[model samples]
Target: MSIPIDDLPDIPADLIDEIKAFLRLDHDEDDPAIAEMAGSASLLCESFTRQLLVARMAQDMLPVKNVWQKLSRLPVQAIDLVESVAADGLTQELSSDDYIVDIDSDGQGWIRLQTAVSVSRVRVSYAAGLVADWEEVPTMLRQGIVRMTGYFYANRDSNDVHQLPHAVSALWRPYRRMRMG
Candidate 1:
């Protein structure tokens, strides 16, 4: 499992303006609300694609199944720390010489231990994402997020809606990572 160690970045002001323009709004009264909706849209995009939209610190815990293990998030920028947690509640930080880290061409992260160790789980802290800033995010993703924000704003009163529009899903499908158990 992977846990975010930092809060998601706030929606950029330019994005809020773009969403407002897309909705053809003439007022700034709802800027804060729209920002919130945009944030939600970003989360939906991330969730649907199974990828982080911006750079951030994250921690992952994996069972010691073999000499190597895959980190949950992809496009890993760097591995900051790796620790082995023993069954008796002891933890040992692994040095650089103890393991090797690789991000494959597919953008998945892999860590391989150079030596054998008895442990129940491994804890990894790393940075992973597709882009470092909102402007660096893919154009399709930004467009989808804008449209989704409009959808959310327009349908705010409808409590029955539970899924993203087909267009949004279509825009994000190509970026979706296939997860396997």
Candidate 2:
């Protein structure tokens, strides 16, 4: 059975009201209502974060299986659309980071491909000190000075560097395989 958004636990109306109240307070800093609203929004954010983590896990495991099974029953034309997009380089590396392989109910679906690469800095730290002089410097200064920085980078520099090549290929695989057979 598919998990529905409606089935998820609801956010209380009072909490939502508080969020609105806080937003209003942000505009008018003198309002005492802002404090209560800020507190409510913080609590709500934490609650939603937890719920989102659970939901993501369920989505990753469950919906993938269900979608694949459903796709298997789709018409040949839908599969063909996917193959056409793949052949046309719709999943090419210059696109954004996410791609949609749509298989419409009418047996005609299209592939929308996006590719993105993100680079971020990673800090590595080391401590080198005379064992006897370790206590002379403040802990905060020592910690700050001992850090080294490096970048974690990924880019689709070429057409082959795209992350979803298999998913894109899989989108058309059924049709191609069928044609071959």
Candidate 3:
């Protein structure tokens, strides 16, 4: 499994004024709550899409199976380490020449092994994401978060809320990573 090593996303709050405009509210009044909700929406969007909305370091402990293995996150910027884990779950550095990482913005890439080993664990440390900050997050994703925040805020009284709204989903769909069988 892969684990994010970054602190809470340095993702900036969505533009409160933009949200206010979308809601058709008077410009003079500010809904401070939208800032917090926007952050939540961004995190939720990241979680739902399994794509990091901001750039940061991450690690994954995966069993080295077959000659190819997918890295934990897509849009991987760099690979810091490739280690072997012992039966006791301890990590030790491995030579970089043993494998090659192929990554792309589409988030479809894998490590190609040069030689097989009996070790059951391989740990990968890498930096991956669309951008390093909220400002750099894709326009559609930022818009989606705003849309979601607005949806949640407007639907605060609704009892049955289970998924992201259609508009928000459409905006995020293109960025979502597709699984191949």
Top-TM-score structure, candidate number: 1
Per-residue lDDT of 50-160 in model 2, one digit per residue for the tens? 211111111111121112222222121322111112323242222222335554544322334333223111111111111223233233222221210000011213355
Q: What global local distance difference test value does model 2 have?
A: 0.26
Question: Model 1, 33-85: lDDT tens per residue?
Answer: 99999999998888889888998888998776556688887678888998998
- Best candidate per lDDT, number? 1
Clashing pairs in 2: 78-107, 95-115, 96-114, 96-115, 97-115, 97-116
Off by over 4 Å in 2: 1-8, 25-181
Cα RMSD for predicted model 2 = 24.5
Report the number of clashing residue pairs per model: 0, 6, 0
Using lDDT as the yardstick, the better of models 1 and 2 is: 1
What lDDT would candidate 1 get against the real structure?
0.88
Candidate 3 per-residue C-alpha lDDT over 72-127 given as tens digits, one digit per residue, 9 for 90 to 100? 67678888888888898777787877778777656655776566756888888888
| Model 1 TM-score relative to the real fold | 0.90
Off by over 4 Å in 1: 86-91
lDDT measured at residue 159 in model 2 versus the true structure, 0 to 100: 50
Q: Score every model by TM-score.
A: 0.90, 0.16, 0.80
